[model samples]
Target chain A: MSRHARDDNVPLNADATSSRDLALEVENLRTVFHTEHEQIHAVDGISFNIRRGETVGLVGESGSGKSVTARSILGLIESPGEIDPASAIRFEGDNITEYTESEYESIRGDGIAMVFQDPLSTLNPVYTVGNQIKEALSLHQDLRGTAATERAIELLEEVGIPDAARRVTEYPHQFSGGMRQRAVIAMALACAPEVLICDEPTTALDVTIQAQIIDLLMDIQAERDLSILFITHDMGVIAEVADRVNVMYAGEIVESAPVEPLFAEPKHPYTRGLLRSIPSTQTSGDRLETIKGEVPTPNEPASSCRFAPRCPKSFEECSEVAPIPTAVGDDPDHDAACLLYPESMTTDEAVAHHRPADDGGEQ
Target chain B: MGRWEYFLKRVLLMVPIVFLGTTVTFLILRVGPIDPAAAIIGPSGDTEAYAAIRDSLGLDQPLWIQYAEFMRDLLTLQLGESWVVVRGQSVWELVGVYGPRTLWLGFWSILIPIFVGLPLGFYAGLNPNTLADYIASFGGIVWRAMPNFWLAVIFVSVLTQSDALFGFSWGDWLVETQIVTPPDLSGLWEPTQFLGALKAILPAALVLGSASMGNEMRIGRTAVLETKNANYVEMAKAKGVPGRLVVWKHMFRNALIPLVPVITGEAFLLLGGSVLVETVFAINGLGYLFFQATINGDVPLVGSLMFLFILLSVGINILQDFLYTVIDPRVGYDGGA
Candidate 1:
């Protein structure tokens, strides 16, 4: 980014986003799927901001709506799945929740592109890898014929694919798992998106390839100064990539913190459980520590803390009341949505504050 | 192996299967209770006449010699004269007259469904679980459930009667305006002749096409549904591909992978349906000829028609295999693996 958000220019904990130039700012995003049986709030009211040239992490386990949040940013959600109207997804400065389908067609790939998990299924098996990339090029950049073809080859080489000129003519099945992911990343970068939403882009690859892919992403981000919203379940990956992290559980962000402080002195009980579950922390023969219950999915309205069932520090108040995100330490940037903090919203107060989101898309 | 090489190999493979089929058919016909000699020379005829009829048919020769002669005649493509179907008429000459009629009906039957069912299924699949899908699905089921013979009877009855609508007899218009008698297939390219031949075959085609059309619709809906949500399709959308391109450019080819067998099988299915449909309409197509040949123990007529049907079915299957390799890169042309 030519213009970086100078956070130091403003006071540390200012309430609004006026001072820092946010590349993408989301507030009160509630996405749900109204099925025949019941309503599924895939991503409940959650908020975060990504500054230009920085990587922000959205970490959650499977079904915690990390991918849904990534898709909602691009307006990729179809019917039966809906983004609540009150949500504000401001890209750069414009509120994009109001963007029409045609407008989204223009904005996607050009303004913000995406790279998904599972490289095997991500690329079309029928077309040559070069042709798939060229399609995106022609759609957004008006590059066609030889120009598109040359650029596709150049992109493949740039992503470190050996014999790229020849490989570009090959299909997805011909490429190994790692090469396919590299090709996918090359396509996402084709239209030069300002914000890249990578939903577990490296998860499907082996460890060596996974590290290489992350390194490739960082190198590209530095070259172009791209802002990325990296969503993954891996905390180790989050620590490496993110400047700031938002930890989600059951369709809600339970904690938001600068990566170092959050990992060093975690506040939320759920975040603690995640940290402990990492196998590397344990002795070689010792059984790994894991949170007891399955990850909760808040299908109906929840008046109590969503993680209370699996929380090690659960008490009567935790089961009886919801908690609002509040500062856990003097850092001001570190906040966790747990009633353990003295200043946090508890019981009736937190419930009333979170009421507007509960009205959902039904009305 | 190269695609053409594979295709050639499949063609060569067909020879043995066909030979086996013809040999099996010959054995089945010969062992039957109805002896050709008795059928031709009735019970009233004397033993001298029965012996004369048998000699003429070459049935007096040993079974092995008769088989050898039959195989030789088959290899030379000389189907012998019909014993009873057209009395003493050659089988090839009979097929030339009747083959065109049934083939014409099959053409219309197959063509109508592709245009109708493919689009209908695409629409239903795109808007799955909606009212339009439900309506199309219901209609498809009702049409498919009706047997060809039953539906052909209804069509004949409906078109047979002249009804007055807006002072015009639509029933007569449908049945008689373009009814060609004894099929002048040579003039079929002329507009009037073309339409008349088409009209004569319309009832049979509609009945024959119905099941396959419904099948295409249902299978198409399923294929589309399966293809639409594929991760690759979602990747197209994320790449800013327009909706139409996402469906046609990305999803269509993948969806076609599953529908290939269904499309190829429609030919054999229509041929099967043609038997009942031709009998109902009394159209004198190959199906009617086959029916006559079977009952009269016209071995030459039955064998020739059976060869054509076997060739057609095998050819359709070969085409289907070739199509799969063209549509899907994952399926290699590895000499049928």
Candidate 2:
């Protein structure tokens, strides 16, 4: 790789060493979509960071703004997608907001790459896998026909494609579901980006294929020291691979903590509900506990805490004002937007008073 | 039976239908309010003179007898003479004379529409939201809305004043005939009259071309747009495929497959519409003959023209099916084909 000059135009602070070590830092990012009727704040002031050589999973149910947050970081949102001025997506110490579309192209596949959910739709039907991969390689690397093709074959092999030489020549449709996804991964890995955004990449695959893909991604991440922002609704998958977890609800990150701490004691009621809802043999009830109500659409601006309506531990204080980030315990890293803490609790402790009775009744 | 077998059986069944179409045409012409024998009686015939002429011309015969005689003559390709217009010209000879001109005009005119319209539509589809799509779409609507007669008048008026259109000017019709004749069939490159015939080809082709091309462009735009939004296209975009390759290879090839039937239908439409176009342009093509027949109340000529169109329609439909099978293998004769 060439020792290319870093863009001088990026806003920087020499003393702000904290942001430099991170591959991507999204600071209070909010994305709103303007429709004919109203403005929807899909990603409402969600903040997270992915460091080099780490995998961070954003877990949420449908309409959780998990995908929107990832797309916003990549600048993939089209017209009507309104990002607030306050939000800053700092990629490798460079605020991405400073780059125009043409300049954004430099960071898109090179600085940070993204792999979409559907593998079948991700590869152009007309071009061979080799051609598609080679095109991306050539874009970031200056290589001609044969050299680019050789590199493409190497990528296919790296992604564990059998008969990579011959399979590279085949079009996307000819490949099975698993192989197409492997091919997509191969394309994403071709440029050797600093960070990779996998948006539910394994969600479309079967159980066996999903395991293979997850393993492939892990292997690639180890080899490249790549930071990955993995987005999925599956907590089990998060438990399997993620070092850190960000739990989002209705377009806002409700709780974020280290994986072990989050799995041990979920701070937010919404997070507890989500973890309980995951189907498992040990939780041998006829019905799994579900988070009540649907995720609110952006059309209706969320007031107070967005998840307050669905939170089982909601009290009158929950609806009075919007929840702010409050430490659940002494650990500064472990935080949630809930009034569960004693000093933070304002007004009648109606829900907390019912807690002991609820526990006894359940037993 | 499979679709092909069923289709073949249906087509075979249409042989009788075609024969019926001809028979009905003959009967309708016979029952028309004009007298066929009036011209034969020298236009000064008394009632008794008309009766003698009718007897000789077989007009006095019973309806069944006349039908039987007509059937025999049709089978033998010996159509009887027209009573008016070409007073002594055998219907077969007259058809032989006029059919070639009409067929030639129809063939070229249809080709003009397909070649111009499809590409224009494709370009428009590729560049949606750009000036190209807007211009092509607007042009398509304008041409489609204009009547063939109105188009013909404008084309003639413009061509006559300019004396040239796209580097070709109106020439005498003698060139096509000389080229088709025996001595010239030996491959002498007769460029003079051929170029001249091609000159007026513009107006006829333009009128037919505008109508069919406009319709084809609209369909092409839709196909291209739908294809552009296909999942594979998104993949291609992510894969960093250039815009041109994405449009041409990914979207275009797939999109064009669905348009095979529409293109074939346009061919037939242009061919039929050319008749009106030719009359309006004052081109001495088969359309002129049909127009003259209608104006002069030449029922036999009019009936034959309508019958010829039915045959053309059936032939074009068959060609369309064949093209569809060729374009898409998934569309089989048995089911989706």
Best by TM-score: 1
Number of clashing pairs per prediction, in order: 0, 1
Q: State in Å the error of residue A31, model 1.
A: 0.4
Candidate 1 per-residue lDDT over residues B152-256, each given as its tens digit: 888766655535324555436633453323344667768877776777777678789999889999999999999899998988888888888999999888888
Q: After best superposition, candidate 2 residue A208: deviation in angstroms? A: 1.9
Clashing pairs in 1: none
Model 1: CA > 4 A from native: A1-20, A342-363, B1-9, B162-168, B171-186, B333-337
Candidate 2 residue pairs in clash (backbone atoms < 3 Å): A122-B235
Best by lDDT: 1
Off-target runs (Cα >4 Å) in candidate 2 are: A1-17, A300-302, A329-331, A341-363, B1-142, B145-199, B239-257, B286-337
TM-score of chain B of 1: 0.92
Model 1 TM-score, all chains together: 0.92
- Model 2 chain A: weakest 10-residue lDDT segment is A1-10
DockQ, in order, for the candidates? 0.50, 0.20
